[model samples]
Target: MNNFFEVENVDFVVGGNTKVKNMSFSIEKEGDIVCLLGPSGIGKTTILRAIAGLEKIKNGHIKLKGKILSSEKINIEPENRNISLAFQENSLFPHYSVEKNILLGAEKNPDNKDKKVSFNEIVDLLDISKILNQYPHQISAGEAQRASLARSLLSKPDLLLLDEPLSNVDQSQKEDIQEKIKKLLAKLKITTIIVTHDSYEAFLLRY
Candidate 1:
């Protein structure tokens, strides 16, 4: 398969001991949704962190669409990577209003002056128009999760990394959010990666 992502002969070590040794893999092709399935603390999120330029790799390289995203030889910064990430917690700005956070891309990026999903459209899609004026704390975890997804989409992400995006939600609330995620992701149609232990949620993400 043509690769959208490629990690070759990579090795990373963090903290005093956490290490991923000689790891190599690739996304099947462009638009392929893949997951790194393992128990917690298995360097799953670390892998994503490496890909997102949030962490530095000790060795080897990461290429997205044939452009090097990261490597010890050439480390690219996170903002320059075109990768939007929504981790389980601390994904949104607590100080900014939901509308403001969603439109941050347009604010930082003048080139996106004509994005298809305008601020209003994103708020409407996530049913967050009511909370557009609310801070991250004012909304429910589920609502914030949805809003975070919307914000990521608004960035026109080249690759979207969801690090267990729904882990903070209650079990009963998970399916609803999971469905919303599937629908929203399907609409956005980008190269998406989900980090989670929920097999059911994984099934829902089986696009």
Candidate 2:
């Protein structure tokens, strides 16, 4: 796999305490999904937050495509790093319609002056076309998750960071939802990293 985002000996310290240990990993354009597989509170989300520039790394380096995105001496803001992150919740605007929220990121893009990806495509792909006129509060957790995925992808992000996307969905629907998400990601040729505690879900991502 060609290296895209590399984290070397990264550390996060706060209140004179170290949270993240000496961590090192590399994610690339052609790489398979790598799970951070560990128990809760082991700095998994910390790693993603650090990469997204939401948390400050006190040491080591984070490089994206050979460019230093974050380091001890320098820090790049989240929006400029092409690192699109979708949290477990709070990914959409409660007031704006689905189409508006999906195209929100395109406004910051240098290209796509007219927002090339049509709103209907995203809505249909996510199976939320009927809910496009509805607010975020009106959708199911699964529907909201799909909208979040679509929103992040519409940004044309280089790296995707998902945090337990299906955690809130029903157990019976987990496998099916994961399959759909995986298919959409493959279709888009997007580099994705999914953070989940389910072993079976992670196993399916190994391909």
Candidate 3:
């Protein structure tokens, strides 16, 4: 049997600089959560981008469920990869309400309508139901982060990538939010790879 997901001997280059080199990792089963822990500028985000098909890898291969996603001779478009990436920065459309932004993700696959997570469930878990009508500019950084996360989760992707997922959360609520997210992921059983600089966060969400 093939591994669920694999990144082997990958190298990333940008602007004539080598960002990452010889990186290799694998997720052996579905619903496994893997954390890529490192400091800023160390290419953690780059790795996520590469896996998501947002960036090209200069060497090696990325395979999902035994299908090649990226390689020297082939690069799949991001939309065709069945992967959702929650960016480190809030990326909601400026003119769209929070609810609309989240809905966009689910709209990607009409055939998976019944499989999508309930809107209310995610908003309630992220505590963003009250701000459904609010735009991204009107919410706090933490709120925006949660909204982005909600969108990603609603997409029902085969693989989920979260970049600094809780970086903007307030200190008092950070731990609580973390616990809620952990439980939510477990309940959903979505295969995930989280990128973060926090060791504690990595440990809490570790496979």
lDDT, model 2 = 0.74
Model 1 clashing residue pairs (backbone):
none
By summed lDDT, the worst window of 10 consecutive residues in model 3 runs over: 108-117
- Which candidate wins on lDDT? 3
Please give the clash total of every predicted structure, in order: 0, 0, 0
* TM-score-sorted candidate list, best first: 3, 1, 2
The alpha-carbon root-mean-square deviation between model 3 and the true structure, to one decimal in Å, is 1.4
Looking at model 2, residue 64 earns an lDDT score of 81
Per-residue CA lDDT of candidate 1, range 1-207, in tens? 548888987886676454788899887655567766668887888888888988878777899989888787798999888888887775688899887887885554446443345667667655678878889988888778877877787886778888887776677766766676577666656678888877777777767
| Residue 13 of model 1, lDDT score | 60
Error of 1 at 76 (Å): 0.4
Q: Per-residue CA lDDT of candidate 2, range 1-207, in tens?
A: 547778999887555567987888887664345666667777777778888889888779998888898898989988788878888876798889777887785665548343345556666655667877778888888778878877886776667787876777777766766776676666655567777777877877644
